[model samples]
Target: MRMRLLVVGLLVAFMALTGCAKNQMSTEPGTQAGENAAVATDSQNSNGLSEQDLADQQRQAMAAAEQEITQNRIYFGFDKFDLDAEAKDVLKTKAEALKAHSEWKMLIEGHCDNRGTEEYNLALGERRARAAYEFLVMLGVPSSNLKIVSFGEERPAVDADNEAAWAKNRRDEFKLFK
Candidate 1:
């Protein structure tokens, strides 16, 4: 244990020295770092794309993401809040879009079939939304940019009492806010 502590202490000292050296270099006269930063702040990037081109690319990506978010619904099995593989893929895309647009927020709406009691369904719906919310946070989407709502059986995607309709109803839907 003493030997391990000695090694850790040495590593920390070395890191501190390295950090000081880096700071000194940055402060030195005629440093390349300042030049590099100036070049970076210029209209043309290292990728050879001008600022206008970069802006156009960003706009195109956001537009594509806007269309892709329509595929954002996450369906689950009856009485289950777990996300399936397909749902995860959909969420991955949603996360990318959310990250792409920093100012955008998402609303995850949880719904259930018209079978369970009102209170129970509401609780279950909340769980479902929380599950998706947690997953989105895990995927690096900010929690502050997300809101959850539980509609329970109040809103059914399909009015039929059949299993197919229930399957469609047991879902979490995504809506965007800018």
Candidate 2:
């Protein structure tokens, strides 16, 4: 009786595994009933994005990610909120991208190095963030799509006391929201 029960259990397990395999195989592209089953002909998929529209969105997202990784910051001089020529150029490119994607919104965060009093750094960070925000607005990016905040000296990009670390910490960072 034990032998018979063991055989039955093995058979049930085998059947269960085969059932799962069959379900997986049926969903594969070539295993569908018709060759055209893999093709999406509707202008809009169930998610409401057409194939072209989905592709476009993917490209935009990739571009935005690359920009954020490489150039989404405008560095500032110590105790200064003014945009240098290079900072202005960076903002121009960012503004153009913002214009291209009207559905996207941006948060500009102002940060400062750990050289000043907490209260003073906080106020200076706000000024730096506001400068970037105003520059983007002047470059034709919609004012409604931009928001600003100040981190002051609380969140340092680098913790060292050297000039290089201080320079890295004093900047405005851009974050994207949809």
Candidate 3:
């Protein structure tokens, strides 16, 4: 009986506090129901995030993940599709990001230098993209979240006829879905 009364008293106190806050929340000129709900939740949730707060955090997280995945292009050797140590490290980071954010979907775009025939370059590009895709899958990213496309030598990061340009071109790139 004593415990029951204590519980009831606590409930009353909570209701009083919530009521006061919720009322103050509605005093604004154009307060909506959702905004009020968010305000109420802010006072209760441990995360201390209202609806907008959570949304903003999620957007920021995705942007960070997108930057991690896209900024470091995975370059391959001449006529090679195998991953080097640097590429593997980058993919490991990417896999961690993808694992943390399963809601994110991405496209792995394969590219090549303008040395091989169009057909060969296309196939090589596909192979390069597949290599990255397989590595990510091995590191525990869901295959369903990833898709691959081969641009072959059509999209060059540095459009010049030099070893440096070719090295940049012989790479795999990443794109995050909107």
Candidate 4:
């Protein structure tokens, strides 16, 4: 009778550890979540996942979101509305990314050097901003996802009256919206 009891206990232990039963199909004979993947779909076959699968999918999604956020910065040139070849290259890359992430939105901030009148600079800045906006729209970024604002000569990047300062001040900056 003692031998029979021991044998029964061993069998129960084996079944529990191996995740094996006549009604279930467990390829790995273990319940280490991902380990016995075969039995996973069975529990959720009608509805889905054992919690672990859902978490993994969420993790992958978050990783992709982070990667997209990392790649989304844009730069511009000095007092220029038209995209130079270099700026176009960069914009192409940005446009492709933005197109891929259709849900993303952007704000384009147009700036100018302090040499001009505030009113004149504001108009110039608007022109510059619109140039970028138009180009981005042409490249497949939806018009609705883009907003343009002109800072005029109000925000001087260098805060100095020099060629270097003017060059740095006149630029279009890109900001992403979550």
| Predicted model with the maximum lDDT | 3
Worst 10 residues of 4 by lDDT: 66-75
TM-score winner? 3
The 10-residue segment with the lowest total lDDT in model 2: 35-44
lDDT of 1 by residue, 28-123 (tens): 347787676666578357778878889999999887897776555889898899998999999998888889887988888999999989999999
Rank candidates by lDDT, best first. Answer: 3, 1, 2, 4
| Local accuracy of candidate 4 as per-residue lDDT tens digits, 55-141 | 888788755654543444334465457777766776776677678778888777888988768998898888888888899899989
Query: At residue 26, what lDDT does model 4 achieve?
Result: 43
TM-score each candidate.
0.67, 0.65, 0.70, 0.62
Compared with the true structure, what per-residue lDDT tens digits does model 2 show for residues 131-156?
99999998888999999999999999
List the candidate 2 regions with Cα displacement exceeding 4 Å. Answer: 1-71
Question: What is the C-alpha local distance difference test score of each model?
Answer: 0.88, 0.86, 0.91, 0.76
In model 4, which runs have C-alpha deviations exceeding 4 angstroms?
Answer: 1-79
- After superposition, the stretches of candidate 1 with alpha carbons farther than 4 Å from their true spots are 1-58
Q: Please give the range of 10 consecutive residues that has the lowest summed lDDT in model 1.
A: 20-29
**Candidates 1 and 3, the one with greater TM-score:** 3
